[model samples]
Target: MAKRRREHLFIETDGQVYLVRDRGTLRFPRKGEELAFPTRAGGTMDFGDDVVRRLKPVLDHHPEEWYQRDALFDRDDVDGLVKRAIYNTMIRCVSEVVVSKGNRVLMVKATRGFSKGHWNLPGGFMDYGEGPEEGVLREAEEETGVRVVLDGPLNVYVSGFPGKPAYSLGFLFRGHATSEEFRPKADEIERVDWFTVDKALTLTRNPFAKWGLVDFFLQSPEARRALRVRRHGLWDGATRAVRPTVFLDRDGVINRGRKGYVRTPDAFEFLPGAIEGMRILQDAGWRLVLVTNQDMMGWKLVPDRQLHRIHEAMLATLRKEGVRLAEIYYCPHHVLSDCACRKPRPGMMLAAARDLGVDPRQAWMVGDKVLDLEFGRAFGCRVAWVGPKEWRDRFAKEAAEWHPDVVADGLLEAARAIAGRPEGPARGRGAGRGAGRARRRGTARS
Candidate 1:
């Protein structure tokens, strides 16, 4: 009988997925060769050639260390992108419990592990062939020397280390320790202590611990209800939840974006064919969401009440046209503010996904500026740009990294391109996924 190959974990970020073979070693699959990574179900998936091509430039600088242990996973940040793809090859499945005594929760200082020396909840890697319930009970006793009877799961947190090809899907449960005393394992834990929620806030270094504490203590009843819906398999994973939505930028794509802000209802003018274009998208079964940058409002150039009225009018106009927008979210900060929700930051898109049960990777973003295109790309969405000929031509030349999937003269043209296709992101307009001219904007009237 042959021994089965041990599974390893692979990580894909910003479209670059790489594999590390040994737990503590660094290894890269061959270039221009068909390769497979083990999946969680004991199957293998083809790691495509495109992944190899993107990795070559980095390999040239450290050819000898390509297969060295911890070569790629030890960095602070793998360039600018985080781990968006976490393959099950080397994933760790663990379970932790929040066993609180009075106002204090149980915490242990880890003597070793990925988060060694950091204060973490009582948990460890789930041994193969054991259920999560069995694993959590066993881990609690093994680490803290206190047997626990778990009640119900508080929440599940999926977290990954920066620049490491590993991730943990952890189940946090609320339980009570059988004994109030504890003896820390000499190898795995330094000490077990009870800390108040406020004190735990300062000591807990693990992201999952912090998240679990918030879910247990700080989350409102309404938020808890929302969390239940999210936890019930409406999402695929922690990173990308699959919801079909059309993320639209307000000023340019919906209305005629001008030099100054659209401050009043009178100034909120829809561009020609904008209403009909929205109707076409709605008919095609795409959820409409408005993601706009209203930096003028944050700067006090426009009052919040007036801005609310403007959005109300926009929504009312769409409803009159039989188009229902799922939601409207705007970033009210200056371009220089560097707020997370600003255009190009992807903060609002992520928040929308969490709030609306939408999947960004499977959605579309239609906008008119370079920032908008970048924002779509950041969230793994298909992008369509609506702009004048001169502006489109300039983007194609200078900002290819932010190249849009489709280019149109206005909202109507962009909508036609979107509706003309089946359900999918618009491929490059006659560009063949490389540098080429966008298809000339159609002249069809709305």
Candidate 2:
């Protein structure tokens, strides 16, 4: 009879049973070497010479179990084993770190494995009994020889290959390097270098790594300042006690409107020319602030953290295009809740005025819906209606009543017209005493 394949060897030591897997064959750890025994929960425990000493006694007690002949497999048993093997799945934990110094970020070129010859963040598969944070720190040191001091977690990314049952869950972290010098691991890393955020984004080949860089760009103060310099040059140090501001609506105006809601980052997509329009406004020295109604939160359709993740990705994309928002405010009340901050109420605008120290009268409110127009009118700001002609025709009576100062094809056209006007408040339908009275009445009611 052919010998049965011995997949694992059992070792008993100190009243404990340990398993040593050797890929369908039994092998003992050599002197000064340690063997890893994987636990039932997918973690591993290491055992060395102490366990090795008891191997002989365990083999002596279970000689038949260890050296048993290959059992004849019936068709039903073989089929069950094949089915289980085919359907079994496993999730691997991976951790990566984005190490930064001033305006530069650290990245490594890989010499081996799947990402060979491409640049990637310094990280690897997590080890036994290590959490993501601890694993990332170890990986950073192992690959780049840099001790990273973690600032915080950035995001989690999941990846799986087609036709594969295993998936990898990656934990990304942001950190600052403790030392400038790098000693790249010779076996896995080709070299390490620091790069500007823009350059690093171009060099990174892994999608998950790129997402981490995007999050870093959004959260890093130094990176944001560097981006500002690249976009607008050095701030001339001119002080403006009251800068002109633009209050924007989020869903329909900034991103494509969704039927249900933008519950995930994957569902959020920028409308055509939206980023360019925002860039134009920013370049013209306008402080962009987002004011939106997010009733999804009130309805328990989306969690606050999930919504924040969506915005993080949104802001990161905008920053990539050289546009930065001064602030974002959203009403987390149900549509039927009569919340003061909801559109058509002046609560959000009032808060914006006090927080940003900008006059609502001098600001321009741009949105696609009629509630947005009414909100701007109530706040005593010039309003621009953004949509196609069909939409305008559909809401002709509301448009006529609201009398938006500008009705354009979209935000790009509206922004161009608004930016061309002279510095001071443009002569529009909604400004001065009547609008102020309207604002006062709205504030009083709220």
Candidate 3:
């Protein structure tokens, strides 16, 4: 049998190793040759003691003529190979802290590194000898200038991307800041501020940090409660407070309702006048929010990431037309499950009220289904049932039973009626007398 090829490096008298390419062969550098190695950043740096130590094991087993360090450090694949080597040899540990004050989480905007300009938790790679908890505290202080007193470990997450050579074992901790004051390291962090749990979730783009935040919100009752309260910032006192929000149902009300599910972005198509109706409501000083039932997630009919992509496409389209939603809340439970967030349960509405600081009693809920009307009524919202007259007639018993304030053919008519504009002609019952009767009877009854 042929002997296995051995890869090694030549060591000098002073314990430094110099590699050079000569005549298409890799060999030890001549006495007066430059001492440096190509860096992944397209520059050269000293081939220091660290590299020497890493290569020592290979040196111990291989013969002098078997030097193959240059093969491992080939210019074309050096970065990936080095990363793979490190990843295979040892575990890369990272630590992050979720620091909270009241119902707000502290977040930092990265000024450098891969997450530049993105909001992230105050954390980083753990030091060589530091414990995960100690490393997290140190990182928190370094990034936000606040010493965090840890409550406990929130979770341990293993994260990596497919086809990527690097991965990390991340430790997340729940903690509280010593003070509100922050002096962010200017070189690494651009800004340090507190955000409500919902806002923080939207702002943080790093998956690891987002997962940690999600875990913190799920595990901490205090954090969950904070999500409902209005977040008041330093400048909020001088500004007009929260606006009345209009809770919209997603499928039939905004986009064309699908049979099974929307499932993908390509399958999502907006109904005519939907964007115009939303824009009208937004311009009329109403905060637009979406409350939807996405039970396909619970049933495993669609993955969470696919749903996210669909929403992203929808939001991007709305942005193109100058409309924006304040927040989106969806119930991801199966219809058979008794979950609080499902339609007709009032959970999503209550959470929306808390997060957006709007009273549901003064808000409007426009949707096409009986459950949507019931959901709005459950939360004391003025409900508008949007559908053709035939559809309303088919569910006439439910219509009279729920007593929706406005019955419109589509979202545009509903918006007009809600905004106190003439809705052309009465569709089923106008908001004038119907709303008066509905309000007098109280939405809570039947």
Candidate 4:
């Protein structure tokens, strides 16, 4: 209840009076309870005759989404209707991420050739069989030459530009200047200079991004703190150093595997985003590593040479896409075989982490199985589970036999969740559970 109380902010929603507060439900009935209006969307609520001049900017920031369901603003701007998604939505898209010393963030310039005319957190269109996370890293590096350390999510924003009719999501993450060495692609950036928050706001045209259109964004003195740029640097050995590691998983996380080990290249199926993901990591200067387990091979069900062939095929596929892989790791052992390389055991994860020269905890372990999380947890890596919640229910319960972490419907959702995407395109409803989950993790035995 303390997150918000009652406040009197007149809003124009079907005559519904909303007590717009700092960060909670904004719309309220005249004599009833206040309903959630939306935040980062705090712009339009203040657009009244009494304070027209005082809250014009806020009104302008009401966002185009509002018009999708409700009313419209009195005065219009070409940028109107095309606005940033709610701040919470932004968080959902790239909700949050980790930061380490010396990471590079792309400051893409708006060009006649590109989509916009201002700098956006660096990223490009999703590639065939590639997730957004990898695309962003690849785009950043292909545009800017610095190697990067992709830590975690930050925020997701939606905005519109002149002549553009659709909404584009912004996936921002915490990053740093990795090498202090950067060169922009031709016209990719008019001028590239590291600018802090204050400097960013000082930009000629604020790109009409989520922050520019809303009042709540820069309203609070504390809110404008960093100009919304990501954080950089972590102390180590009394000095700061660059840390870039592309975190990936084996099985569906990387090459291709489903329900069992894909020992032979013939069984390999690069699940959509595999190659592009690796490519993005490589261009971004992040050390690419595959943390995986090949248990079936131990049972004589899969072939080692086939595993190698699959990896070779994966690399070849990446090459065709103008992308490349950094490194590959896998555990060719079984759970009952008493070997430490199997998933749910940190042996493989630890080995991969050590090989990559990164703290297992700081690295990302993106996978489709419960043991994926187990290995990540065991080796001290941040875990990202990609799969339908229902598909994962039995597994989550099984994973209870080990630990808990983030879950999604494959690497794409994992990417959006990691990048902090607001809302995914509507999909089929989940059955049984109110949240539509078929099974939920309760507890498990080892």
Model 1 is weakest, by summed lDDT over 10 consecutive residues, at 437-446
lDDT of 2 by residue, 40-145 (tens): 2121222321221223232324333322112212223222222232223336688888888887889999999878998888887888679999898888898888
For 413-441, candidate 4 gives per-residue lDDT tens digits of: 56545444222111232211132121122
Cα displacement (angstroms), candidate 1, residue 29, comes to 30
Residue 293 shift from truth in candidate 3, angstroms:
0.4
Model 3 agreement with the true structure over 1-446: per-residue lDDT tens digits? 85543232333222233345566654543333443432121111123322211322223332443334434554452333233343343457888888887767889999898689888888888988899988888889989886779999877766653333335777888888888788898899999988765556556645567556655665567766644322112122222223467889999889998888899899999999999999878766677878888989889999777877888889889999999887778877789976657777666765654444544434789999998987776565578999878988899897777788889999989887887733222333322322322222111100
Please list the C-alpha lDDT of all candidates, in the order they appear. Answer: 0.64, 0.66, 0.67, 0.45
Per-residue lDDT, model 3, residue 66, is 35
Output the lDDT of residue 384, model 3. 92
**Ten residues in sequence with the least summed lDDT for candidate 4:** 49-58
CA-RMSD of model 4: 20.6
Q: Write model 1 residue lDDT over 1-446, tens digit each, in one string.
A: 85433322333333344554435533444333444432222123333311312221322232332332234445543421112222323557878888777656888898788768878778767897888789989988999897889988877656654333346776778888999778878898998998654345446645566556554543233322322111112222433223357888988788988788798899999989888888887776566778888878778899777788888887778878898876777777777874657777666665665555454434789998887887776665678988888878877754466657778998889888987765553433321222112211121110
TM-score of candidate 4 to 2 decimals: 0.39
The predictions' CA RMSDs to the true structure, in order, are 15.8, 23.0, 22.6, 20.6
Top-scoring candidate (TM-score): 1
